[model samples]
Target: MRPSIAIAGTSNSVMARCYAWVLSNSPDFDVVNHSRGASSSTVLPYALGKIDLSQTDFLVIDVLNNEENFVLLGQTTIEDVKNNLCSALDAAAEHGVVPIVLSFPRQNFLNRERVVHDAIKAYCRELGVVFVDMYEMVEDAVERAPVTVYKRSFFDGVAHIKRPISRLVGSRLADAIRRSFHSDRVATSDHALAFDRIEFCFPEPEAGLIERQNGFATEKIACLGVGESIGLMDSFDVVGIAFNSEMTDSVLSTDHEQVISLKGPDKAEGRELMTVILPTRFRSSRLTVTGEPGAKFEFVGYARHTDDRRARTRVARRSVLPVPEFDEQFKKDIALLAVT
Candidate 1:
């Protein structure tokens, strides 16, 4: 259950692809790659639910070039772009996704101040969505153009220039997404679930005794879960966990168990926890926390499998973890006791 992300923008949008590629490779993401061409408007289809809005935790909109062209060519005004952005933001909010607006990348020949990039940036500020400045990265690349021109030894041909510029833009966009996902704004909750430290370990030969050491080296694990009552589908964030295992030469491996410690809200005092266990063969696995009748509790399990033939042949039936079964009244009481 990796955090799902939705990317929206023009088909040729470099920033959109960069974010998509990064998220696709990210162990923490189950990415939904969405790109509409110039024929489509931004706010309409998104609001109509033609797109899977519920699956989107991160919404990235790159409207710089389109909006700028609209204003500069007299197709629209700054106010128009602002209005459209506002509508889009409202639509995203309605769908319960965190919207991120990306300022247009600076073009080599375009006058920066005259473009609608600033208007888009301002709109994002007004709407309270995350605003990322791609202009700075574009500006740096422009400044380095002279060296590039000299190295190429061809003044008339500008095709080679697109390569470096695209890389620079893509890299910056990826870096921004990486930083934003880990920011304090994301980790903190309205209630007070601030995680302190998280550690993951494999079950030792002795049941209930997790090895003090790390798990197998090759398996990469990332944890994603949600409280059963939380209606918001994309309500969780990926937390990095440290593990000490004997199977690997390295102390840490990307493929390992994901252990998360949940911090209670201001009024609550205890932590609710969950873990994602990555077996060697399954696509993913989930461990949920459940409370029992008195003070007892346990972890429940759900496993995922893809259609990979090799995995199916290698792995037998999935194992279910021991979990405490609670009756309706006890479950209700436990829910009432847990923090919002």
Candidate 2:
């Protein structure tokens, strides 16, 4: 079947419109055009279910700076655009769709072109989203023009560009869509793996907990088992179990008895002592440690399955040891690392 694609943006989002037009004309695509009235906010249409589609393979957003008076309003900040784009893309991802973000077209009146482009690039990087640099592509085309040619041939005014630009933009965008479709097909086909069961365990450190210190001794640690002894990198499906302090023992103490829903990895990062942060005000609970005899206390590693759809599981026990607290200072450290 032809891959299903959705185009969403403002009325003057020529990039989106052009993409729709190109996809409609392409033999390999089934296109859905969802572009609405030109505006800064796209969250409404997405949230209202107007753009929702089943089996949608790809989504394109091209409405960042397409309004009539956008440039005159004032300079737009990176945070403003990043938040809106993240919200829109997050909604699409909730339905298992991949999103493509289109950079704003290059306009001469905008003084902070590089800043805007860099911000968009950084946001995409942090979120692991795909990006298309329409501005750079168009700029290259303009620079190659004859010196005597009027800029009007390329752009109508400072902000809005002309139709010929659309054709050039459309052709390139169509090529990009085709390439993206091909890559997606390959990825979906190659990454399918079936699993019967998966488990994840984290070690919690309180008193009476077994503590292992790494070389630096900066952090006290515990070991959580990733069920089945499979290689850490092997991607598998899993079921997730949520546990509060009160219900800790019934879940983790048993072996694969009561599991919740199956879940795949939402996100994974470099290995560290994964600690579940409970509300500070909650009363402390107790847990039976696995290896350490006579150890029992509050604070447990949260248990979840690699596949969330298949089973429901919960923390069966809590461990006690001396662990570094993930307090406000730790959070600030993380924030600084993120900013740098």
Candidate 3:
């Protein structure tokens, strides 16, 4: 299936004028732009909340934002901006949403050491988020056509970037999205989750430390059985809809909370291993797993992946020609380790 991407940009019309316009012509993508003009970093959370993450595979947010109108005017602080961005990231992860942050085309304004972009970069690297560097893209454009860039101006008045430049950015951004879909990103820890995968070794239960939420507790699994199936849901987002019968009295708790609970159940024999993950700006919260009723199962280690890791790693072999081995006889003392 063709992957989808959502554009969550703000004023200055970069996404509207450039990225969206270019992507509109591409058949490989289905773009949903939620960009609003005159919006600032302060409105990011609200802006993100409006996006219907379901049926959406990727989210695009811009960095190196407009410095003059937003930051300098005190619409938001560097710290608050980070907080908002981090929150949105958490929401995205819950839905298996991949966020690709686009770089600001230029440092049109410099406010507070450019910490916004720096923080975003650090978070993306930590979380394995895809980042497309617009600077390099723009630099290549200018270097290739210095005269045209300076003469006609790549931008259309005030801040809107011309459609041509936007199309170029969109093409590169599309390529990055495609690559990420077919690639496996690494998550550093067992409790870690990435856009590509989430895995954690099941923790052993203690006598009095098994925490429960609304009487639902996730237990460790040893193996899965036939006819057993697993699915994911976010309690925080989906409410009032009866997704499954098992969720009754179910609660969402972290590993730390579960591990620190007073006691564990006597048996986990009938429950299947189910894992639900929601990654954050720093890292994701703890996961909870449950099994389908009437299934002969017991929970074990949990794992979830968007793509098969092995399939993603399948590399096409290039036919290698045999190289002749060199010997002292063949060298014939012709070569010497000499400065001459």
Candidate 4:
């Protein structure tokens, strides 16, 4: 028997041509869409009520476009989106519905959607639902063809994806849904939404350094000054460090700062993944990651930072890079950093 798939969200979800593409390509798949072209707050309740949960083997949702737009314009609060989404998920869970979630794509790489994605990610992690990390998805697509972003925008003010990107997004999501259905794995770390935790950081005192965020965090990380850096004050275990994107200038790790380099795999675009790592042992040595504009640095594993007067900054800081979610769309055979 073919698995029944139900698609729901606002225009962003339903407008992607991927839905029809998936149905037409997979002869054994049964697909139904319950999404509409308005704000999710307005459309979601109705979409949920109308969907036949009994027949839905998988219910895939596209979050962000509706919610993000609302939050950006002050039409809705992030809290309201969270509350309404959680309520919908609760009802889906009660009906034995297997939920698969996704966030819509963006060209400018806004964190507005990341807020929505994170909201759903937290709930889905608790419920063991699958989230197709859209940030990672589009990042790969953008690297392939930067113009793909335009295809993702509203077409003729219809709030729908263009034909080309629609096909791409749809086909990819279908594969992800099937794989997620079969793979019985749930992301254990808070990194499920792709935002790496700050093992240690020098945020402005009382400026705030939260690990998880649900709204527009304009200043998530303060940009470091020339020759100034942030790092572990005392030694702790560390597997790797991620140098997230939008960097116009390169960041350097001098030989003296020997935390060792745990390099990540090459991206699909053949761009080297900019990560620093060390081999299989814990060192008590301090590891400081310097920063420049256009890049966000995330240190992996437990580390420490001295939160003194220096930790506090007069200047506000935020990440120039977009949210760093896991790049799960592409599959590549690669090796991990081999440490001594």
Candidate 5:
């Protein structure tokens, strides 16, 4: 059987479908992508959770572009960047999967801030992680060329390089995977121990606690009515939720005194997955959904980290940017990516 490679990244990974296409064509490998667009390092743990690393050989990460964007918007900090990076690496280690972190080229407008990417590179060096400097590779390939070329050649005028450029990048990524085999496994001491306890919890749809509160289920999601409560049966520092797009503002309270107000997205945009931070960690707490009369909420899931800080950082969806038209040849592969 060929080795399997999984991708966890932002829009670049979703938009540049040809990269995974190129890798899948290689005789020596199989590829699966679990990338979501408009995401940052903040979503790595959630994305990585979807991958069964026991059957996967390598994980490729490309979130520096969005991470920097988050920093530029003041939604996160350098400290959070380090925590996010370490969370991805440490999670990969737990399953014995090798991780290859990629740094893609930033748009000309964002070229001024290199702090996030620099911190990532330094952290990788310190932990002996495999770091792929695709940013430098792309820059070196287009030496002495005008800057407008990136805008013209890229899909989003940023990191999402259009194919055959994406195909070329995929080929390079495959080469990097082969090269990683020669590297040593990460030593236990090399892990940034501070962010070592990253964990995700998904409540079962049929839990008795859910049924007792008049909670119902559609598909696999548990629906909680206003003033209803459900137990996750695990410790969590953050809760991920979504509500009916038409619902009015609502609030969620935990036994730990954590209360989060929920605002539904515009009816046109549909529902959105959001993260809510619990001010205090709870070992045996239950979350109760409360809102205005007739208001209801859907409890998606929760994430448990060393503290609430890691869960507080949010990366806003960037949908206003234009993306190039998809290539017909790669449409099948592109359709398979979780672009949202």
Candidate 6:
């Protein structure tokens, strides 16, 4: 059977849609993508924990660009981003899947610091996982052509490359995959223990967390009126609230000096909004969520992604090349676009 490849990435990966588009055309692999636009690396560990990757062989992760955005916005730190990457790697190891970390160029490649991409490379080396650096690839491609032309024709000049460049990149990645095949290597227990395991707890409706609602009710959905509050006593990296398909604003406070303001979906329709208290790391912490005034939304069940230290890892019987190097032909094809 052909190996299966899965993607757990951010908006760039989704917007490019290069990997899946190119890989699916091949006869050697089955592809699936689990990516969300406008999301950062903080959410990947939570997502990987929820997604079923038991049948997956290779997992590609690309969130450096988004992580950089968060870092620049002062919402998170480099250390926290690295820790999130570690947690994500640990989650991938649970399924005994080979993980490839893909790093893209920063939006302002010429001016911005490469701290996040450098950190990603460092983590990939430390964890013994594959690392693909598309930043260098794009940089080299631009050198072959005028920067303005490359920016106008190929790149969105922000975060994503155009479809043509995306296809070229995707094709090169597919070629690399075809060359190396699948890896049987997984992270060691000591490696996995280096990070905290993410755990979620969904409170029961009868738990008295919130008043049960009559309409649009489920075990997981509790209703909170304006100024209503719910509390959880435990160790948690973050607390999540599944608000109804309505716009609401809430605040999450920890026993320590931490208060997180959360906003539900902007629109009054669509899926339930799952917002979390972030930039937090507290143990045995008491958490409180209070709806602000005019907060009219179903509480849904209260949930939290707590950090748990557990030691578990799979043994690797063999190893394959982790990084994918583009062939001469692939390099030539990318360069041809410069003059064409």
Q: Name the top TM-score candidate.
A: 6
User: Residues 1-340, candidate 1, lDDT per residue (tens digit)?
Assistant: 3445666654333233244455466676666544432311232223223357655656666555455554555544564344344444444554555666655442432433655776556544543456665444333333444233222221113211233333333444455555555544332112111111111132223224221211211222222223211111122222212211111111111123433332211221232222212111111233332232221212212111111112010100102211112334422332222211
* Candidate 2 local lDDT, 282-335, one digit each (tens): 111222234233322223232222333312111110121111133344333323
**Candidate 6's error at 340, in angstroms?**
8.1
Instruction: Give the per-residue Cα lDDT of candidate 5 at 206.
Output: 72
User: What C-alpha lDDT values do all the predictions have?
Assistant: 0.35, 0.39, 0.42, 0.43, 0.55, 0.57
Candidate 3 vs candidate 6: the TM-score winner is: 6
Task: Point out where model 2 deviates above 4 Å.
Answer: 14-19, 43-48, 67-78, 106-117, 146-152, 184-340
How accurate locally is residue 18 in candidate 6, as Cα lDDT from 0 to 100?
64
Model 3 C-alpha lDDT per residue in residues 1-340, reported as the tens digit of each score: 7877677665433344466666656788887765543344433443454467777777777634553334555533554454445555666665666666665544353212555566667755665555554444444444454133441244445445555555545665666566655655412221132222222223244312222222222333333233423333222211001111221223333434431111122224454222221112111233333334433323322222223121111111112211112233312211121001
Off by over 4 Å in 6: 24-27, 145-154, 182-193, 200-225, 230-233, 239-258, 263-293, 296-318, 328-332, 335-340
Give the candidate order by descending TM-score: 6, 5, 3, 4, 2, 1
* Alpha-carbon shift of residue 154 in model 3 (angstroms): 2.8
Clashes of 5: 0
Off by over 4 Å in 3: 12-17, 67-69, 110-115, 140-152, 184-340
* TM-score for each candidate, following the candidate numbering: 0.43, 0.46, 0.48, 0.47, 0.65, 0.72
**What shift in Å separates residue 218 of candidate 3 from its native position after superposition?**
42
Q: lDDT of model 3 at residue 53? A: 71
lDDT agreement of model 5 with the native: 0.55
lDDT of 5 by residue, 1-340 (tens): 5667888776666653467667766888877776655555655665666778777767778777766766776655666556656776665665666677777666653347588888888877766666666555444434433322333344445556555566655765676566554455433334323543445565574752232111111222456778887786555444233233233346778776767665532443333332221112344467787867876665545555555333221111111211123333233232222121
Model 6 TM-score (2 dp) = 0.72
